[model samples]
Target: MKMVFRWYGTGNDTVTLKQIKQIPGVEGIVWALHDMPAGEEWPMDKILTYKEQADAYGLHLEVVESVNVHEDIKLGLPSRDAYIDNYKKTIEKLATVGVKTICYNFMPVFDWVRTELFKELEDGSTALFYEKAKVDSMDPGELVNRIANELDFTMPGWEPERLKLLAPLFEQYKQVSAEDLWRNLQYFLEQIIPTAERHGIQMAIHPDDPPWPIFGLPRIINSRESIRRLLQLVDSPCNGVTLCSGSLGANPDNDIVAMVHEFKGRIPFAHIRNVRVYDNGDFIETSHRTSDGTVDIAGIVRAYHETGFTGYARPDHGRHIWDEPCRPGYGLYDRALGIMYLWGVWDSMRAGEVAKRA
Candidate 1:
């Protein structure tokens, strides 16, 4: 597996590219142009600026976190064709910078939902937390405000532009069922997947944050069966899954290791993280260590090794440690620690394989 780190650009992030380079095995940065809004084509100069910055640090700028899919496309509006064309142009430009995979989601309102950004645990180090009861009981508008209030930087999915249109977006989605969303997604894939194929880039669709519907939104990309169906939608090597352990792991039913084995060549990017899940349906992001969370980090790494996975892998969200003020889940310390843990797992597995072969 090729290890990569998620670096929010120059001024937007607390972690610097130099710090990222210090991590032993981090081969690249999973990056994006965060300032640009959805449906707008990214400028070529901006894309090359990121490439130059990563090159300065000897890091590859191959995996982009997201290129936001406009709600018009998800709504399958008459204007969706125009947005899809914009998406195609963005893909072609990213290809110019040698970006191999573009990680994005199709959630209607929020990209990911969490009730608390710094929910303190018994250990004193805080992490992103989800309280199921809070999400179910709270008004979404209030929830968005609460989340925005906690962040110094704008949260990606909860952008003010999208949030301002929430009421109308919900009204638009009122007529869209899960099936309609699937059809719209298929339409999107049909239009853009061919372009992605021609450019040699993989369109890695991130699974729904919690792998379930929230605030009455129909979330279709939530399970193993949904993944299977998604692959059938475009039926091309270019159309693929991002396979995030924490997101899909929110649902206990998802067999992440099995997905590693089953989706073998179809997965181009993997977001490896752990979460401590409770019986009441709430979860907290935990360190990448296997014992710290419910997800089996060791087993997942082993499966990847067995499948001969050489695609990009990243240590996903991490805890806020050392009292460092950083993005809620994108902190540097814990994520760097997570990378060490992942490297340990991967190295041990490699040693075991060598011993067996000998």
Candidate 2:
């Protein structure tokens, strides 16, 4: 697999390109036009600016973490047609700059819900955490305020502009059942997947964080079965899943290794991280080490190896470590350490294969 690192744009991130370039085996940056609002076509000049910066650091700008889905499209409104058209154009624009995969999610209202952004871990590090009790107790408005308060960097799904419409957005979705959400998603895929294919880009959907509905909202992309159905929606190579371990692993029942085998050709981007799930339905982002979290990092990697996956794989959210001033889970030291641990496993597997041939 081709290793990549997630790099928010200059001044938008605490981690620097020079620091990312130092990570061994990282050949690309999983990026996006973050400043571009949802449903708007990205500025061509801004896209070129990102390319120029990555090029200066000798990094490939191949995979974008998210080109967010507009709410109208997710709501299946009549206005959705306009947003879909905009998304199609965004796909074409990103393709022009060699972006191979556009990772996104269809979850309504919130992108990913977390009770704590900096929950202190046992080792003095902090991690993005989900407290089931707190989530159940708090309203969406309070949660939104908490998420936006003291945010060091961009939280993809927690965009303030989107959250500001919380009341109206929830009202719009009150009538939206899971089935309605699924239908809207299909409508979106049928319209845009072909465009993505034509542009040589894969439209990869990230799984619903926590793999469950939050605040009575519909979250359809949760389990293995849901993803199986999602692939069938468009049934094209360009339409695929991002195969996020932490998100899927929250359920404890998602067999991530099996998913690798099930959707082999479809997955063009992999967010390989770990999360420790508690019996209380809570979860926290953990290190890449298999023992640190519920997800089988080694098995997942070996499965990708067996598939001979050559797509972009990036170390996902990492804990705040070494007292580093970072954007919650987007800290550099732990994520860099995560890459080493992930590569160490993959390289060991490769060595074993080479020895067998010898």
Which candidate leads in lDDT?
1
All candidates: CA RMSD in angstroms?
Answer: 0.8, 0.9
TM-scores for all predictions = 0.99, 0.98
Tell me the whole-model lDDT of each prediction, alpha carbons only.
Answer: 0.93, 0.90
lDDT of 1 at 6: 92
Candidate 1, residue 96: lDDT: 88
Model 1 TM:
0.99
What clash count does candidate 1 reach? Answer: 0
Stretches of candidate 2 off by over 4 Å are none
Which clashing pairs does model 1 show?
none
Model 2: lDDT of residue 41: 85
Q: Report how far residue 38 has shifted in candidate 2, in Å.
A: 0.5
